[model samples]
Target: MKHCLVVDDSRVIRKVACRILGDLRFETDEAEDGAAALEICRRQMPDLILLDWNLPTMNGIEFLRALRREHEGKSPVVVFCTTENDVAHITEALGAGASEYIMKPFDREIIESKLAEVGML
Candidate 1:
């Protein structure tokens, strides 16, 4: 199964994403902040990343930038799942190496479609 890392500061969001990814047959892991997520990546880079924008220690953009700078970072498909819905935010995320973007208040259907679009499903 493909491994997925859900990075969000909200415990609820992380739990929800993990559960959805799990149901989709992905091996799931989660981190409450970007720093923690980066640590996890250092140990094991996941096949996909479901990321949130605002986070403690390190924000999503910073994490994406840092992750892309790593040796194996470009291998993982980064998908920004966040409340930041501005065109600029989306542009920045995509420019920073995110493969896709999802707005907040997402459900299983949305997640499924987005994953499929990124060819992760």
Candidate 2:
């Protein structure tokens, strides 16, 4: 089974994502902040990451930069799942190496489509 890391400050969101990914047959891991997510990444490289924008310690963009810089050829596919719905935010995330972006209040259909778009589903 593929591994997925769900990085969100909200416990509800993390649980929701974990459940959805689990249903999709992915082994899921949760992180409450970008720093914790990064530490997890260092220990175990997940196949995909569901990232949130506004985090406690390190924001998603900063984490993306660090992950890309450090992992390079081995970086996981990062999909920004956040409330930041502005075009600029989406552009910035994509430019920063995010594989995809999903607005908050997403459902399984949305996640499935995103995974399909990235060829993960």
TM for every model, in the order presented, reads 0.97, 0.97
| Candidate 1 whole-model C-alpha lDDT, 0 to 1 | 0.93
Mark the 10 consecutive residues where model 2 has the least summed lDDT: 68-77
Deviation of model 2 at 75, angstroms: 3.2
Count of backbone clashes for each model?
A: 0, 0
Residues 6-89, candidate 1, lDDT per residue (tens digit)?
999898999989999999999999998899999999999899999999999999999999999885445799999999999999
Model 2, residue 25: distance off in Å is 0.0
Q: List model 2 lDDT by residue over 2-36, tens digit each.
A: 99999999999999999999999999999988899
Error of 2 at 96 (Å): 0.6
User: Tell me, what's the RMSD of every candidate?
Assistant: 1.1, 1.0
